[model samples]
Each structure stands twice: as C-alpha cells, then as structure tokens.
Target: MRSDTCQHTAIIGAGIAGLACARALDAAGLPATLFDKARGAGGRMSSRRLPDAVLDLGAQFFSVRNATFRRAVEGWHKAGSIAPWPASLWSAQAGRWQRHEDDLERLCGTPSMSAVTRHLAKGLTVKAQTRIERLVGSAGQWQLVDEHGEHHGPFTRVVISAPSPQAHALVAPHDATLAEACEAVIQRPCWAAWALFDAPLPALPGVDDDWQAVRVNDPRLRFVVRNQLKPGRQDQGESLSLLANLEWSEVRLEDSPETIVEALLDAFQQALPDGSRLPEPSALGAHRWRYAQPDVFAGGEAVNLDYRLSASGLSLCGDGWRGPRVEDAWLSGHHLGEALAADAI
Candidate 1:
C-alpha cells in the first residue's frame, strides 16, 4: 500500500481518453498515475503483429474535426507519429461501389493505430497489466485496490475514462446517481478480422488506384481496408482487415476466432466484384471489441453526457458520454482534465 496524494491523480484506463486526459493534466504541471488492464496502453486503438504483417486491428483511421484534436494531431504529424491517409475511400450502396470524393482529412497513426496512444503515453507513468478493481477511501480522495491485492493511491483526485460499464462498476458503490446514468449509455460490440493473403483481391473498376478502404452494406461485415496501402505500412504484399457490423458482432461476440475469421472472410469474398477473386489467406486472426461504439440512439449532439465532477474529488470522462469517436474521447478527457487542473491548482 502506498499513501501519497502529492497533487497527483489516479487515472484509470490508459485508453485514448485516459491518455488524452493525462496529457492535459501534465500540461498543467500536475502528475498522474495511469492504470490499464491490457499489456499495452492503447486500449481499443490496437495494433497486432502477424507472422507476415503488422495490422492496425482496431481503429483503422480517424477524421480530425475538432480544433483541439486537430492541433494535437498536427503535433503528432510533425513528430512523425501520424500522417494523412490520402488513399481513396469507397462506400457500398445498393450493392455498388461509390467513390468517396469528400477529400476530408483522414489520419492514422504511423506504423500502426496504437502508435498515437503510445506517442501520447510518453513521459507519463502508466501502469499496464494492472487492473484497479475497486476504488476505496472517502472525502474526495480515494485509494485504488488492484486485483492482485495490492493498493495504490490516496490521490487528491481520480479520473475514470474506461468504457461506461467498467466505469460504472468502479463508481457505483460510491455514487449511485452517476452509475445509473452510465447504465443508460449504450455501447455495441465489434470484431476485426486481420487476414494476410498471398494474392490480394483482384483489382475491380473503382478499386486500387482509387480506393483502399471500403464500407460494406452487407449484414455480416461493415468495413474492409487494404492495410498495406496505408502510410508507413508495407508497400508490397496484400493484407486486409475486416470489421464486422454491430448486429453481426453482437450475435458472434462469443464465437471463436477461427469461426469469426472464416465467416468474415467468406462474407468479404462474396461482397467483392463479380470478376474479382480473393486469395485464400495465409495468415488469419481476429480481435473482439466488447464495447466498440456508442449506439448514440439517444443523443443528437456529439457531447451527449455531461462529465461528473464531485466535490469529493471523483471525476469521470470517456467516449461513452461524449458520443463515439476518437475526437469525442479526446474532448471528454480534455474537458475533465482542464477542470481538475484548475481545481488542483
């Protein structure tokens, strides 16, 4: 057990939101102790290394719409951690491909999707593979107890940026009102199947030179991206990542990796153009995201739920309240971090 409240905060969940929040707090000259249950810090912005290729198995790309997020992305871009994905995009409507001519600024982390979070994690004290089960203590300051029976904190403030379900579990015994609100937040599951092929899908009319990613209207799959075409990725060989739609993912959420990979692969092949052929994949694996996207069926605004800031020193922020996007996650964390910084100072 460690008892120290030296103007430091315990930020649970080292995901994008957590990392963003901690970055803001650090900017204000405050220290944060970040904790995550995963072996790495990225959370849903995950990247996986296959026997033949490295894939951005989680969030393939994000559009920078917010001024704050744009500035942050620019800094990362200048630092060579991120870059604009100029490759064309395609949308499937009425079973036909439609070239996306929006020319919007779509960006992705260099090397892999997790690179952005890894860059933001620099100079921050993050505790990986440590799950802080329940928060204990009172009067605005609480200590966190890990699953290993170890104790940490006595911090002046705590910010929880985990998925709403997990965040509710941690804050429930302490604040029922906040927990009830979190229960109302809807999140859906998703799965990404990363498949490496000896031969890529044959070029169709509007593919290759025109589009590297496509949104499928199929019931089984939602998105497919040619991983090798992205900047900082392998220039040769063929790799594809298939993201399952919300409804399909919900039904197959508990399915085996082999089952999901096979199903998504079959669906992708079927969705391809009539003359195209998908080579039998050489390497195949899948990642399951239990809390993929916020249903957002209840809110019209991006920042739907208000952040929680108790006088007792407990705070909350995440994409759950701020809608579902990388930008929303960043904003939720940043706003709460700014408020916490002001109070601590």
Candidate 2:
C-alpha cells in the first residue's frame, strides 16, 4: 500500500465522519474527494436560520469525554468555531443535579453547528448535491454513478462514512463482505426538533432555570433545551428557541414534516405552565433523523470487516461503526484514516 498506489480515495457523505476522515487523509498527504447528497456539508451538525437568529436543528449539544475529542474541541474553540454552552442537567427525578459555571463543557458551534463543518471544509474538494446510486468495480478501479447515471471516479479505494443503510446500499454490489458488515449496524430513527418563539418562555418548576435544559423521561417528552440561553447565546437578546424529543416524532417519522412540527408544538405547549397563551413561534421546524443514533454500539472497533474481505483499500467508518456520539464519529474517522495511511505505507 504505497502512497503512489493510494493515489485517490472517495469518501461518501460530508457529515462529521466524512469531514474528519477527509482532514485525516489530507493530513497523511493523501488526496481524496468527499461526496454528499445535501446541498451543503454538516449532516446532523445542522442549523436553521430564522428571521433574526439561527437555531441548531440537529445534535442539540455535545460533550467531549475523550482526549482526542477534547483537543479537537480546544482547536475549534480557539478558531471561534465552537463555544461552551453553560448548561446544567435538569431531570424530573434528579431536579437540577449539577450546574457547572467554571468548566461548563458542552460545546456548540457558533452561529450554528453547521459553521464548524464549513470551517473544516475550507480548501477541501467537496462535491455537494451529488448522490451516488451505485459503486461499480471497473478495470480494477471503483467508479461511482449518481441517480441520473452520471459517472465519477476511477479511484483505488473508497471510504464510506455515510449512515449504515446508505453505505450498505452503495457498497453491497462491489463488496458483499463490507455490505454485510454494514447490515449489522442498526440506527434508530428520531423525531427531534427546534421551535423559535417571539417572546421569552415561562419558567417551569424544574424545566426552566437560567438555560432551560431538561431531561424528561415521560411518555410525551424526552429532552428540552432553550437555544437562546445556550452557552454562546448568553449575549444574544431574549429570543426563545426550544428543542423537543417527542415520542410521536419517532413513531410517525414517515408522516409529513408539517404534521410532525404541529404535533411537537402541541406537546411543547402542554409541558409549559401557562400552556395556552404561549405566543406562536416565529418559526417551527422538524428534523427526521433516519439514523439518529446507532441502535447497537460497535464498541471501540475501527472497521468490522468480514474476514474474507480484502482490507487493502476498503474501510467502513461512521458513528454507527464506532460509538454513538459525535466525538465517536471524529475518533472513528481519525482511526480509519491512520489505519488506511499505515496500510498505504
């Protein structure tokens, strides 16, 4: 696996795993192309723009428990890409368990989580709005075809960092072993969201504190966060945004987005005290994460390839393949990059 032999690598999906893999490959002096179906990067590390402010629609907040992830968060902090959200855990049973003012660690990207990916994508060759329908092995090289049958790439190796199901579809024909490994990875669908308000929201007993981050295990609510009171939002004036993890969202994921938004808004109102008069939100949005979190954690494994599959230039990497969290995605990508680089050398 020489550097010249590994001339090109094709990475699928421009989410955290894909971006992290691209950065790691570039750092190893390997040229790679990143492809994503979205118009822009940052899958799950997403945000929605309202009239005056932005709301984080996916991945409400993340904590760095791993050393590698901590260092990366530090770099993002210095670059002004991410900032600490001074948050305390409020649970129905625990009741505001711990509040850390000194080292409040949960971090979110400034402006929005998507900004972090935009910063990382700088100077990288990213192909957006490009969907890969299939991967074909032609003339001893891999070729990617879009839905319209447009072909791209005759590369030596391909790294799929998309969700497990999507990755399985792309690589199944070319590499059955890898595809079967992907089939073992299951992701849970989540109907989570962001709701923006015109006026300040009322403070619930244990729900709304300084920041209104609550963990409700009731059948109706899962988690809630006040976006305005989030870490970087201390200075931003009183614009209220709420994130809800609704059970119904998970149940009726295939339903229309408008229907989901309305249902979640109703649940939100019920959770509040003055429930009825809460001003109609300036904007309401719903996000359906088909693979929100991995149903089964892959432990600390790098690539769970089938023994029969050749590991020369193929790898599977993503949050589902490694651990569940965002940090796990980053670490998994970094691990896969190092493994590929080592094999290349």
Candidate 3:
C-alpha cells in the first residue's frame, strides 16, 4: 500500500516455500506479490475441516534435521502451532513395534498441517486462484498472464514455484536449458485417504503398543496415524483422524471416492480386533497427487533458474528445481528473494 516504485517480484505458488519467500522479501523491505492457483494457502501442507474433526491430507508430519528448520520449529512450538509426537515403527521386516523414546523429536502442525502454513503466511500479500498462464518479457519487464489471458504485471522479476513439469512448460519456450533442467527433475504420484472416526478403536496387533504412532507393514498400508494420540489431540478426545498411506490409495486410485473409502474402512476393520466397532466416519475423502514427491533429490544446488530473458528480468523457482518437501520449496524461494533483493540494491 506504500505505492513504492521498487522492483516488483512475482512469486508463483502459495505453499510453504512461497509463503516463506514472501515473508523473507517483506522482511528485507522488498515489494513482492505471491500468486497461487489454490483457493487458499498451504499447498502440500493442507488440512480439511470435517464434521467431527480437522484432518491433515497433505503432509502427515515433518521432522527437523537442520538447525534452521529446528529453529523455525521451535518458534512454531512457542506459538502453539506445532507439537512433537512419539515415533513408532511399522516396517514389514520388523513388524509393528514402538521405538524407544529418544531425544529426537518428530513434529506435526497443531490441529492440522495447514496451521503451519497459515501461521507462516501471516501479513503476506497472497493472491489465490490466480494462475499464471504464460511469461513474456517485454521492455525489460516480465508479463504474467492468467487463464483468461489477462495480464497482471510487468514485474521487475518473476519466480515460478510450481512443480517441475508445469515449470518446464512455462519456461521451455524461452530458456531451453532451464526448461531441460526442469524436465530433468522427475516426480512420483501419490494417492491418500483421510478418514475421521467417531470412536477410539482398540489397538491392533503389530500396531502402536504405547499409543503414539502406528506403521502398518502391510503392502497396502504405508503409514497410519491416530489423531487423538498425537501431541495436540489429547484435549480433543474421542475424535480420531486416520491417514492411510499412498501405496494402498494408489492401488485403488481408479475406484470412486465412495468405493475407495469403503475399501479402506474394510481394510481397517480386518486389520484390528473389534475394528468393526470403530465409529462410522463422519467424513471420508481422497486426494491424488500427480507429483507427490521428487524422484531424485538435488543437493547443494539451488532449485531455481534465473534468466535475463535475452534482456528481460525474469526468473523461475519451484520444487522441481529445488529438492522435494515444504522446506526445500521455502529455501529455494528464499534464495531467489535474496537474489532479487540484492540485484535491486
């Protein structure tokens, strides 16, 4: 609202990385506009509001391995946005078992994963449901168009934070090498099922003995989480949320949502004793991620392409160039934001 004439940086995608970029740019005293095609913030770190409870459909949990991420997680914990949960294992080789409590901490967004993204996006300018159809360099500026062919800005710089395939489509015509790099980043699809149960079903054999987390070794079951057992769910008692792994969901991807839900419910019943007594779900849904995870990881390399557009100021950033995960996307965007800010200076 300051009407500052500083270089306008356009960032595509409102996921963790995009929000992080926006926050970083604002802190650096730079003007930026964050665009996302989704209706709201939180791309992969998404949550669904059910009739009974909130469900996390995107990232089940996030662990902090790096100092920077750890510091960020600590801040979130202080803000009541995140909490640590006990870790358990469900490997086919080891069977269902609880790992000894260790100093290591596994964290999850409070209530839902979206809580983390929403917290991070605070005070940021985000334009949702706005798609960037194409990028054209004109007179040293970059023009971004929406699906309707309406152009938004002749931005001083542009950063695309979409998936690799989409990013390749956007930049291939202009920068062949950058497009090639984007294409080189392969992604795998994942399907997931989220169910809300009414009752706290009895524990199953080879499942969580300590009531923490459960990993099912069945080929159909990748990871299973009981919401009530999570760090912040103790107060929410009786309302349990379950997240089924991608392997099972992928096998039933072609099935209708209702069919998939039924199959999952049946599987759940068969896996646990008196599982049939589990509460009838108040809500059931499934999501298909065409590019769920990066096939190969990029290490010590920036997952972004900065192009002068043969004379224009434009750049592209996204998970495809960066490594996978919410953190990777955020770091890449931050890197681009810093680069743009430095160039403006």
lDDT of 1 by residue, 31-77 (tens): 99999999979988878866667788778898887787788888899
Report the C-alpha lDDT of model 3 over 211-277, residue by residue, as the tens digit. 5555555545555566666665565544433445555555666677677556655555554543224
Task: Name the top lDDT candidate.
Answer: 1
Q: Candidates ranked by lDDT, best first? A: 1, 2, 3
| Cα-based lDDT at residue 268, candidate 1 | 79
Candidates in order, TM-scores: namely 0.93, 0.86, 0.83
- Scored by lDDT, model 2 comes in at 0.71
Please identify which of the two predictions, 2 or 3, would achieve the higher TM-score against the true structure.
Answer: 2
Q: Which candidate should be chosen as best, given TM-score against the real structure?
A: 1
Clash pairs, candidate 3, are: 17-330, 160-317, 303-321, 303-322
In angstroms, the error of model 2 at 202 is 2.3
Rank candidates, TM-score, best first: 1, 2, 3
Residue-by-residue lDDT tens digits, candidate 2, 1-345 = 464755788888888888888888888888789989988889888676666666776777788887877887888888888876645656542233333244546877876788788888888899999988888884338888887898888877788888888888877776677788788888877776666666766555534347456555445456766667665555444443334443445678798767776765665556554433456677766777788888775546445521111453566788887777788888777777766666567
Q: How good is model 2 by TM-score?
A: 0.86
Total backbone clashes of candidate 2, pairs 3 or more residues apart or in separate chains: 2
